[model samples]
Target: MEARLKKTECVKQAPLAQILPPVILGGAGFSYQVYPDPNISQVRQVLRQAFNLGLRAIDTSPYYEPSEELIGQAISEPDFANRYPRDQYIIMTKVGRLGADRFDYSPSWVRCSVNRSLERLHVDYLDVVFCHDIEYVTEEAALDAIGILLEFVREGKVRYIGASSYRIDLLLQLAQSVLDRYGRPLDVVQNWAQMTLQNNRLETDGLKNFRDLGISCVCNASPLTLGLLRSNGVPVGSLGDFHPAPAALRTAALRAADYVAEQGESLAALALRYAIWRARATSTSDFQVSTITGIGSTKELDENISAISQILLPTHGSPINSARVERDAPLWNKVQEILGSWLNFNFTSPEANWDVQQQKFVKLKL
Candidate 1:
């Protein structure tokens, strides 16, 4: 049996000074909820391959059941330790949101979650920790969670603090509120499915808002819109019927997928290429941008890396490939055309409403 490696010392850096790769490995795919019967060997292989390819940052959550544990187990292996040290990569996980309908942002839960994540990731300190799905919680609770995270920072349990949400309006409100209350901007903010080919609101509506508040890193997650943009359609089975996108958007996605297939290109790849290119094109020095993609297998990891390489060139002048841009333009335009009314549409998520005075999410009306 291989020996488990002891936790190595990590040199802490300022939150803003830490750099994330153009792509982060999203860990939701590692859970049984997302991928049935996840193989530990495969997970270990994917982690090593991703690190070797320069995609070292990982984003997971307790909400992702067993993901953090699996990742912790993988990295603890002696071979993994021999290849990659703790400080060489980044590990980002979330707290607050537990089950789909459950959330806890109280200070006690915040501290507990942080300590639990530290143990599960097998690290003495986390590079980044997000208050997962802040929009679902009340404004006051979210603020309290951030305060606790700030306390953790002082204690050396965490290096950076952030919040992840699907609602652009709510995210902006939270960032501004944090700045006003804490006198410091969130080190990072993450929004999923908003920066994909079908929706560009994170760029169109969010960039300036976040920049105004001095937020440093903006993560564009779920470039495939949580599997909706793929030819196979929205993910079913263990992921449950949890996709919040409406029927109209799903139908339009199907049409767009079919159109892209007819053109001998994958809608999923086109979407990823567009996302990677857009992130590079829109990123500024003050507000660095990156994308997070879930890789269930080494094959998916390779595909994501290929997409990143194809879009991000080696040239110093511009990271984007003008040739690839010109080639994909028509296909992208046609996909948008197919989307039509569904273009840039924002879907409603569960518990979308929040009552500021009550300090909790108001149950959605049927």
Candidate 2:
């Protein structure tokens, strides 16, 4: 009886979110480009594993090939549906990117895309809908898209509205402008590859902005930093041929990958833990985050879920600190420093070039 008491005390757990999972199950790994095409049954099994492990949200996009359809089938399957009703979980998908280098944020496209997403997810409504990658389109285009999506909200088709992108400045601008013009703030915003072990820009700047804009939450996606900070290294030609990363930066990432391999640690594990640990915190105690990461298979999902649970678990001497976030700051800094000149390699924003930036925020008459 005494041993049982001691064992029970050793467990660590955190409260779940009121409406969604704190950690979102991302669909990018299920995309054809990342993994071999997944069959419907495989997707069903993967979703089952994730749900059993306490993940209650799934983030996908129309651009991620057949990911939406596969997810739809898995969640709507007979056995799973009987056990978990449609209201038991949340689903988020995006629109605005049609093909490689093709973007259309027009009102017509936005409505059409949401309708298709509804069809693919096998749900009458979506919990959330992002404008996809706003950095690649104009502010007017995005605003126009938002107006159309809101129409669905009125019809009870969308629960929340938001945008997902990589550019902090553009996000800030869009949020402020929308608030100024519409009298209501964006429900949420998601940024990728910027809140990981190697990069800290999103935490340093984006979170503070989100708080002021009344954004409900800030989500971090792609904690692997687009595979650069991993041991296997990023594959070539995956992010399209334009590749904003410079040659020198790519070489530095490879060297850093090699350094990571020599440490006798799984770089993927360290990277995942680092991102997950910090993602569980905020600049002020008033904020919270929902991190989205892709899981290519059940193996990857198990590793990621275990990593997150380990980070959230209470320690021997101290409990998980809720007042102050960013648990492994010192260790992360050490790892970043040892990477030498490869540290903090990042993309230059499109706004840096006057002519190119003009195309991204052109004003259009509504």
Candidate 3:
């Protein structure tokens, strides 16, 4: 999961910083999964390669516990510092949420967190900052914190403001609330694990509302459904601990993974392409989506990049993975057919009253 996908390797990497990528290098895996690996040096190598391959932007947060520091150390190396520079790339971080299951949405915490992130990231300003895990806090608190973020923007501390969540419906409400208070919508949002091959809730429920609320773009994280949709199935015991997916859904996902293997397709590969295409495909109401997938190593990066390349090119006449045929219609159909019962299934928020949060966002609408 490590080789970075350069513009030349994939379909000519679009250089428009103003435009989001079909895929973004996510930080959760690097920070959580790969961080404690005995070989710390490998992490640096992966970061360097990812950047060289045109993954110019990075997404991290304090809640990731030292992800910001790890990223800072990698990029501050003489070669990376001189080559990429601060403005040449994007550094996206989040505030308002602390350790796992802990959150603080106060303006004071927001201000302090942003300043702390600047120090951790070794930068004066962040390119993008989100009110991390807003679903845990009330919507009023989220709006107040978002207002504080805008103040940082006015001070040039961050360029764009976003909110990350598992609840797409709440995210849409928060976006509209931002508009109601200031006559402007959220610049971006990161919705996780909900737009995968098995789940399309973001597209079916979140996007149209977002478009009307004037949200500029959406970032889909955990396209592998936070490792639930992978070939190996959910990691060790991640199912019940942090994830909210109930036992019934978990059993169904395992069954689907087994079925996918029997179909002679790597679930991971097919799932990645499905998400990338789903994000890139235009919505009926003009909602745009960008993907943020985490890779643990250069090897994973190569697989992901090659998957994107395969889907971008035609079914034939390419040196990419032959397994990733240009035509994915049958695979899509089979996935829907096999995992039909699990499609569009979502879990209840384990934290906070969802209606309370939604009401706040709803009231914020203009």
Candidate 4:
């Protein structure tokens, strides 16, 4: 067993809202889906560098095969363990949706999953446990899973509980359901691909919904839309093969990427900047906002941090780079104009058809 470390003073005292940084290190890239045959030393270096740079919160899931285990191994290294105790950083993982067609949200599976995650992560307790892709399961099952997580909170196995989904409306509904059923609002809610340059639904449709529910922390993930907005195009292989974006959306993204390239800027960097700006600008006293981005290497980590610094910080004592902002403002508007009808357009998930069938069957039985 790994030796237990003392909880950091700040983590022990602060609430979840204060504990999470504005930029979180996403672990999806650690798996074979995004990166094949990831080196342990590289993972260690990336995690250590991310910690040193203050991107301490790590988000992963079991579905991202080997991600939890790789992270566990990386953080368990003697040098890493000594320099950064477990409490110094936060670990957030998910449960349910084991495979594309598989889901198990029963209380028994919830209990088993939490214990397995603890064992795989080599941690005494998880900082946050989300019901992964709650929209794929029935509402009752989602609620049952949340109740199980809340039990863990009371038992000291988890620090906070939330639900994640690509569907904004479903997330809002689940939050309200949890509140009405359990007498408490969800502590956190995460949605991906909705707060990007092509889509701002998370800002337009999600913020007020979460605020109304009194959620404490809201996270936006996949600022690059699963690599859809990149110059090369949407990724294709393990996870990328399942990207649900329609051809029209993909075409629009390519046009935007071409426009960005013409202006001598990479679409990925522009998207990251806009995502960070939106998260920071929309954050309010009602809830804190954070963005999660995948980092496969130290270089990517540095570039992401650079983007954050450019967007949120001022150089020396001067204000933000207004000149750069002015230059990018027109570029951003032009990209949106290029997107045109695809702006704020959200593509259906790969499982949308299956989910619709399941819902209809449920209604037929009722």
- Model 1 gets an lDDT of 0.83
lDDT of 4 by residue, 229-274 (tens): 7888776545547677888888988989998898889888888888
Q: What is the lDDT of residue 22 in candidate 1?
A: 68
lDDT of 2 at 135: 77
TM-score of 2: 0.83
Candidate 3 residues 257-308, lDDT tens each? 6777887767787888888777766432245477888877788888787777
CA lDDT of 268 in candidate 2? Answer: 67
Residue ranges of candidate 4 with Cα displaced over 4 Å: 1-13, 238-240, 314-324, 356-366
- Per-residue lDDT of 219-316 in model 1, one digit per residue for the tens? 99999998889898786637567787888889999999999999888888899999988888887655678888988889888877887788888665
Worst 10 residues of 4 by lDDT: 1-10
CA lDDT, every model vs. true structure:
0.83, 0.72, 0.72, 0.81
Clashes of 4: 0
Give the lDDT of residue 283 in candidate 2: 25
Residue 44 in model 3: shift from native, Å? 0.8
Best by lDDT: 1
Error of 4 at 188 (Å): 0.4
Better of 1 and 2 by lDDT: 1
**Residue pairs whose backbone atoms clash in candidate 1:** none
